[model samples]
Target: MRSDQPNYDVDPTILQPPGTPVWVADEAWRELARAAARLDRAVVVVDCYPGVDEQAVKASLERVFDVVVSVPDEAARPTEEIDALVAANLGDDRVFGYITQFNVADLYDEARLAELRRRVHERTGPIVLMGWGARLAAPDADVLVLADMPRWEHQLRMRAGMPNWRCKNGDEDILRKYKRSFFVEWRMADRHKQPLLDALDYLLDTTISADEARLITGDTFRSALDAAITRPFRFVPYFDPGVWGGHWMQEVLGLPGDVPNYAWGFDCVPEENSLALDIDGVRVEMPSQNLVLRKPIELMGPGTFARFGADFPIRFDFLDTFGGGNLSLQVHPLTGYIQEKFGMKYTQDESYYLLDVGDDGGVYLGRKPGADFDEMFDELEKAQRGEGSFPDERFINRFNARKHDHVLIPAGTVHCSTRNTMVLEISATSYIFTFKMWDWDRVGLDGKPRPVHLDHARANVQWDRDTDWVTSNLINRIDVLEQGDGYRIERTGLHELEYIETVRHWFSVPTLRDTQSTVHVLNLVEGRAAVVESPTGAFEPYEVHYAETFIVPAHVGEYTIRPADGAGECATLTAHVRGTEFPRSVSGEDLRFSGRSAS
Candidate 1:
């Protein structure tokens, strides 16, 4: 079971030695070496060793590994010891690699630590640590352990206080009583090492995909595809959708696993296509809703908007086999800059009316005051990469989304639907938004990847935004005074950044408010309503649909709408411009009124 060779998952309790000068205890060292043997990999213990029983431990570990031990003697140079182990183990195809433990705290001064890294990396193959020496000596080295540092250090005090800081709060006594230590042991070899590395490097440097290179750029499609599917690609599941009865992802997309939703733009989906794109909004739907949600529209070429818009602009298909699971996350463009910069077809402004959830499910929203953006982002980068500290406060503002609970998510807000929650999403016509942060770093079953938008998200993040411990400061507690049978306005705050006001009536209602030229995206979150053209006007139900959206085409005259039922409440959310910079339009005039124009 040695990781250097091949075996099952390694036991983690071997990290702390049993007896020592707060160093490698005999018992702990044996456990670690035992776990390494189980991994079929020789272990590398990088430490200033004194308490470890080298003779007894070596005999036990040798039984499992073709062991090349590197415990630098006082006279032996660290480089020489490393070279000997590397040459011995790497040369013998049958032998698993070495278990290296250097008293780095004393053996190497700063100069020697640097020298050790250069020499060690020169040795072929991956390296694992028995202790935390490499992180201090060579902070950037690709190192892995079963668990994170157990406690907060004075140096990490600032981050430790931050909510998003990956600072673990656990005691050794508590861990010892438990069966396993936090340390991890897994295979670290790449079957196609050189190819995977080269492909990753190329992807980091290039923007064009494989097919685009042949027609326009010189990008090799075969190479990129090969890189994407390389084995040893890590898979971590943040949450299990299928096991949770109903999941948030399936609910929001309004999909039934057996029956396809035609509005999602797909016709007669194949059985194989079911499992791949089952989650929603993906071409690869799978039977399990545990599908990855990744969109590479940014990499798509120009004129993509025109072509995509002609078909389904904000297209997504999802299956809710069992029902009662929904999602609760809303999105909006950062500031009307999306279409202006990236283009119209690339904005994601949507909302959710969560319908159902298991008793435990709830949505986690924006960061708390303690979890600052910079701190959260840093911890996320490290934790996701399995490199830095671990954030203890991975869950925040997670609330249950009962049926009919309406949440309007504008751009810049952080949110996610929990594992078991069903919700409806009413959104803008343009569908290009992203979750800037994620508490979990698990990838899905896709050999491909779940894309993270840490870079593009910067433009949309509201840095100074804060919320009450319970809800956002923007959640307006307005006093709704009924105006008339055909009119009611629920004055809600988009706050200073956005606005959400609900206009309702029996069937036909008229209001004389000045347009101020701000274009509004109107959607029927409840009963269906229509904007009937005035007598002698061009289009009836101008920008009308029962699906989800309609625009208050600027300069349209006093309009009338009869609800489908004609006498019941007809509701629509009026998403209007928020800042002083947006233009204003007078009623009945079309001059300065421009809304969602094509880029």
Candidate 2:
């Protein structure tokens, strides 16, 4: 089965939430009821996405309040019309509360939203503005309830036509339209929603079944929200299949083998991933962006947050090609190019750290020295037009792979992970800007030729990054930084183009480390398992296994890592922003290694 196809048979019970507190449906309803009873005229606004059961909430409110009025009887209306209707209904003497839907999808005009907010505010009675853009319009609402769903689930629901708000187009057209609108819509929505998170009176996770929906409110919600932003966290990994996907993940990761192939696994992409929160034995998933919006400073630290507002600077994911074909020969736009072209703050600067590989595994990186670029592109055009095959080896340099080999791929550098390799990609979080130059002359899983971006690739490719330069600078460069009683730390890679630095620790005993106010991304690259513990009990200890990635929040201050029981020696690779002050380091440590030189 292709990954893009809907799998309705997937068991909901398999979902396990992150250990946290979330208010169950009954508890949330009861709490809202009690609040409603205490107020003579309370304006409770419930802002949510499509498919949320607003009627159920209205029913819940009606059980406590004498009169509840749902405004703008029409499901969809223009902002001006909605404003007029809301204004006309506001002064009604019999109505105790007004529940109005303010879907952002219907309105893109900021001025119109402002006008609607002004009209809604004029009402003396309590107003319950429900929908996505309500929070942005009514920032000063007495009570704000943010209803959210996991983006993946939302997409599924949309595909299933579960929401009353329907797109006029067919499913295929709907999917195409969504794909085109996703980046812009999500960016705008996030910008408007993030600043209002701290003001939220309640957060409702609507990803679960209607009967099992969960909410987090009051102090418990605050605490849970804090934990989400300021702790070692993980996102529910989402797997997808591509034309060049492989069966390695299906075999090694124990994923369902029914799919054609598993190409990409989004381990911690907050933008596209969801947070699964464990609430009273029930699993509830919410958009991971809520964490960034709620507490950017806590998650990213002060300096990093200041530099890249709510955006998570670093990204960690897997790129598997085992038993499949090579990834497209690609180049990411330069920082300036990306910012000017795509309105992105940062460019995608990536590195491939080989985790596992077949006997003949290799990677295509850099350009061969003295390669004829004009002639190469002319041949590429021919290959793209189905006239001939691309001479890949002639234009690109190939390097044999080994476990734990780090291959640096900064922005503007042309590269791709070849067949029979599983690579852990760590880089800046500006994903989805790849310019593919070649795709092995294969069609997509849909049997269509994948779009090629030769013009874009040609504009960005760093021609000077020849084979010799790649051999000298882009390969594994390690330096022994310090060695203690039972632990040794080595500085792995700190390319001039990268803002983050990586270090590997080979330890046999418990090792203490401090964040120094900079977040650290850790992976147990070797050994069975390791436990990260907080000495002062500031946060709960978390266990990670081989190849599993975890984060250490900057505010955690100090933590300790030790091998799990019965596990002997272990190796963990820690990556963090450059220029962070370390708690301890040896001044004059041996920097030389046998296979690679530190310098």
Candidate 3:
């Protein structure tokens, strides 16, 4: 079709002589078989054009189907007569319909189309249409139009400008065609929705007004807030300013102001991490206000930890700034190593829930197979001594992260969250974790090179040959279940103190049953559930409209849950001590641990 070439019809082989065309005999029979087979399904053959013999065609289709109907070619036939012919074919096993091959181009009438639809519904089987008739068939009629009559891939082939092989251009053409044809396959995303909401939310929230934070994490926060549809919540770690080197964005995460900045290199809130979630209509607040510790003696002032009690530890702040940059690739040590190495004073297990990512955005985790530790250490030694740079080529495995994806890290897994995106991090208690490696060789603002802990990192890195340190734990997954008022408690992991779970109901449901005492943390993951206590007045149910975590004491009373605030069906997560029974909330004491030592 292009101007460079003269037009020449590509003739099909039907006109070739029987013997001269080597492939004609086989092709003719195949066509005869197919055309004849399609005709056999109807009770009467309806041919708007009159070239073919009805009896012979009907005879040929006898083996495959019962009947065939063909329309009279002469225009002398009335619509009623044709209609009667169609009705006559309507039997228990046979019915009449139309095909696009009829070639009735100008026969499109709304009245006739409506009548056809009524007849189709009255008939038991489908109404078939072909070619031009297919274009006029009633919507209710089942239409089976041939897709390849004009060669469906004609446009694609023309776009490629080549016929021999599919090049990138050809592949793209094919992909574009596929995307256009399929529902989920080819649809373009509505990109502005999240961005617009994020901008508006930033404009309204005068407080927490760090422009860097507003720019980087606004989409993530807004998208999360805008999700009115009830579904499982996923957390990703895209906002860590620790990634992309020590950018100004990282500093903004800790502080509250500054804009047009990059990563906020330092954290301001050193004691506790916080998340502001608007669950349903409820505003549930959990602040990191209790992480201060009273050491043997305070150094400069009261330490952040000394002032806070047995509340939550491990704080992380929001940072937003530079899109892409360099950062260390690392993971944390497992629980055993932390207890052994840090004298049982640290706990850190985390995961990344990426909210946004770039085309080249990636995270590097673990080392590749056959990676020589000696060689890696040699590079590390040079980098640490300010001699050379860390080896960037060999050890890392990159993964293309995306929005609403959760990647769980159990610990001792060498990993780094990298480049261009916002992410939410969710993980277990205890914040102390070791960084395994760094890539860039730049000095910080302090005029000293950044600290590198190669020995500690190498000691905790998982080196198993079969393990895929990068993608092993990163996936979008959730478990949803239903149970009665007195719930089903099951153990999901091995540790004796794996976790504690407890459920208490504030309202009495007659179905509530008595259960044993077990130490556990109770979280209203979904609908509101009530707990009944003998001492305290009827307390409101733990409302979990958003991402809220709450602790349930070991011993609680007869707790019953009824639907709260007109909300039906509640979902809750209870993590409990191993091999223990559910505790009664009324007593506030666990007889099982009445005499146990604090340690």
TM-score-superior candidate, 1 or 2? 2
Tell me how many clashing residue pairs each candidate has.
Answer: 66, 2, 81
lDDT to native, each model: 0.33, 0.69, 0.34
Q: TM-score of the candidate numbered 1?
A: 0.37
Most TM-score-accurate candidate: 2
Q: Among all windows of ten consecutive residues in candidate 2, which has the lowest summed lDDT?
A: 590-599
After superposition, which runs of candidate 3 have C-alpha atoms over 4 Å from their true positions?
1-327, 386-388, 445-447, 465-599
* Model 1 / residue 383 / CA error / Å: 3.9
For lDDT, candidate 2 versus 3, the one ahead is 2
Model 2 ranges with Cα > 4 A deviation? 1-34, 49-127, 136-139, 155-182, 209-211, 228-231, 580-599
Tell how far residue 432 is off in model 2, in angstroms: 0.5
Per-model TM-score versus the true fold: 0.37, 0.82, 0.38
- Give per-residue CA lDDT, model 3, range 339-446, as digits (tens): 664433444665554434555655555567777767877877787777877775676565666643445555666666666644434444444354547747665443
Best by lDDT: 2
